[model samples]
Target: MAQLGSDLDATRAWSKARWRSELRAARRGVPASVRFAEAMALSNQLTSGRIVRPGQTLCGYVPVGSEPGSAQMLDDVADFGVRVLLPVVAGRGPLDWAWYAGPDSLRPGPYGLLEPIGERLSTTALRIADLVLVPALGVDRTGVRLGQGAGHYDQSLPLTAPGTPLVAVIRDQELVPELPAEPHDVRVTAVITPHRGLIRFD
Candidate 1:
C-alpha cells in the first residue's frame, strides 16, 4: 500500500468523490450506440483473450444502469461453458454469489443491482474463481481501483486465494496514471477496457 499523510489522505478522498461524479456524468452522456459497441467490444475481448478456460469458474457482475457494460457481456462469457457466478448483495458485509444461469435468471437486487435467482453461495465461493471481474469507476496503472465508497469489494476480496486475477472492468478513459490509495484497499491485478483488452500489473 502507498503511504500517505493525514492531509494527503483527506485530499485523496475528496479527489475520489470528484472523479466519481465526473466519470458518472461522462458515462451518462455516452450515446446508446457507443455504449453498446463498447460493451460488445469488451465481451469479444474477454472471449477471445481466453482469460478463463472452459472449465474455470468466473465471478462476474451484471452491469446495471450506466455501469459501462451490458448484460450480453456476462452472457457471452458464460457461453464459453465456464461457470459464472453473479454477486448477491445479501447485506452490508461481503458479497455472496449465485450461479449465472442466464439473463432471465436475474432479478432486481438491492440498489438496482441484477442478481441471480438461484442457490446463494457464500464469499468462500470466490476462492474458486479463476478470474474476478469487478466494477470500477476508474483504475490506476498501479492496480489501485477507485471503487464506490461502500467498501464491499474491498472487504470481500481478501477472501480470495493468493494471486487470483482480480480485474476491474472499466472504460479506456477510466484508466489513469494515479489515484487515491489506502492500506486496507485491495488492488486489482489487471484491468479490461473496451479497446485496450487486458492490461496486467506486475
Candidate 2:
C-alpha cells in the first residue's frame, strides 16, 4: 500500500509538470480553428448517431484554457435530455460536481475553467452519473489516459460504478499508442475525438 501511494504521488507530480508545459504551448495564441471545426463536425455526427441517452447523468467539462470541444456539445447534451453536471474543483481531492443549468450559471474559476454559480455537491451525488466525459491530454489504445496531472478526475472517476462508461475527450492527434501509467492513473473506457465520436477499447 505504501509503494502504491508513493507511485501515485510521483505520477501526480509528473502529470502536473507536463500540464504546465502543454498549457503554455496551447496559450501561445495560435487559434484552435482547425480543432474547433473538427470538434463541431464531430459533435454533429455524435448527435446524429444517437450514441447517448436521455435522463442519464452526464459529467462534462467546462471548455476553457487548453481543452478541446465546442460549447455546442455541452448545449446539445442538455438539449438531448441528459442531466449535465460540471466539475467543481474545490481542493486537492476528487472533483465535486454541480448541476449544469446552462452557460448563464457558469462563472470563471481556477485555471480558467468555469464553475457553478450555486453550491457544489458531494462526490456521492455523481454516483448517479451514467457517463463521464473526461478531459485528457492524451489517450492510448489500451484505454490508459493522460490527464492534466491533477488527480482530480483520477480520484473522482473510480467513485463511479465499475462500468459507468468513462470517455476521454481530446483531439485525434492526442490519442497516441502509449502513455506513462501509474496505479492511480485512471483509464478511460472510450476515447472521443473530433473525428471519432467514441472509440471503444475494452
Candidate 3:
C-alpha cells in the first residue's frame, strides 16, 4: 500500500510538471505588447475591484519572468491604500513576509526572486492579510491552482485566516476547467484573469 501511494505521488508530480512546461510555453508565446497590456489590465482590475480595503494588509508578490502582472501592479495595490506584504523565499520551507515599501526597497532573494528590504516577518504573519494574492501558472474552474510546482504557496497559505480569500492571479487563458490535484494542494477560493476579471468558486 505504501509503494502504491508513492507511485501515485510520482505520477501526479509528473503530470503537474508537464502542465507547467506547457503553460510556460504558452506564456512565452504571448507578444510582448499584449503581455504588457494584460499586465495593465490585471493591475486595473485588482486595484479597482476592492479586493483589499483601506489599511488592510495584502499578502502579495512581485511578478517575475513570464508571470502575469508586473512589479508596478504591486505598487498599484499599495497605492490603493492597503499595506502590501511581499514574500521572502526562505530555504525550501514556507515563505516569509516583509512590507513592500517601494521599488527602491526590493532586494534580490532566494529562488531568483525579489524581496523587500524591510523586517522579515514569520510565516504566521499571513494571518494579518485581508486578501492573499498567490502566484500561479494556471487555475482550474474548480479552484485547483496549478502553481510553479515549487509548493511555496502550498505551505504558506495554510497560515492565513480561514475567511481570507486565497486568490490566484493568472492570465485569461490560464483558467481551465480542471487540473491534476493532490491532497496537499491548497485550492484557491477565487481567480483573477485579465479579461475574465475575478471569478469565484464554491
Candidate 4:
C-alpha cells in the first residue's frame, strides 16, 4: 500500500509538470502584441469592475514573461487609491511582500520577477489584503489553481485570513474544466480573465 501511494504521488507530479510545460509553451506562443492588448483589456476589466474597492489593500503580482496580465493593472489599481502589495522572493520559503509604489519602484529579481524596491513585509501581511490577484497557468471551475511549479503562492496563501478573496488571473481559454488537486493545494475564491472578467467558484 505504501508503494502504491508513492507511485501515485510520482505520477501526479509528472502530470503536473507536463501540464505546466504545455500551458507555459502555449502562453509563450502568443504574439507579444496580442498579449499586450489582452493584458490591457484585463486591466480595464479589473479597474472598471467592482472586484477591488478604493482604499482596499490588494495583494497583486507583477506579471513576468508570458503571464496574462501586465504590471499596468497594478498601477491602475493603485491609481484608484487602493494600496497594492507585491511579492518579494528572498529564498525557497514563503514569499515576503512590499508595497508597489509604481513601475519605477520595481527592480529585477530572481526567477525573472520584478519585485518592489521597498521595505519587506512579513508573510502574514497577506492578512491585511481585501483581495489577492494571484498568477496562474490555469484554473478550473472548482477553483483548483494550476500555478508555476515553484509553489511560491502555495506557501504564502495560508497566511491569508479565511474568506479573503483570492482570485487567479489567467487567459480566458486557460480556465478549464478540471485539474489534478493535491492535499496541500490551496483553492482560489475566484478567477479573472480578460473576456470573462470575474468568475466566482461555489
TM-score of each: 0.91, 0.83, 0.91, 0.91
Per-residue lDDT of 144 in model 4: 90
Q: Local distance difference test, per candidate?
A: 0.84, 0.73, 0.85, 0.86
Q: Give the clashing pairs for model 1.
A: none
Q: Write the per-residue lDDT of candidate 1 for residues 1-202, one digit (tens) a residue.
A: 2222223454355577776776677778889999899999898888884677778888999998878789988778888777899999877899999899987899998888899999988888999889999999988879989887888899889999898999999989888767778899899999999998889999
Counted clashes in each candidate structure: 0, 0, 0, 0
Write model 4 residue lDDT over 82-119, tens digit each, in one string: 89999999699889999998899999999999999999
Alpha-carbon RMSD, each predicted model: 4.8, 6.8, 6.0, 5.8
Over 1-202, each residue of candidate 3 has an lDDT whose tens digit, in order, gives 1121124354344477777877888888889899899999998887785566768888989988899899999888888888999999888899999899999999888767899999988989999999999999988778999888888899999999988999999987777666799999999999988988888999
User: Using lDDT as the measure, what is the rank order of every candidate, best first?
Assistant: 4, 3, 1, 2
Model 4 ranges with Cα > 4 A deviation? 1-14
Q: What TM-score quantifies how close candidate 3 is to the native fold?
A: 0.91
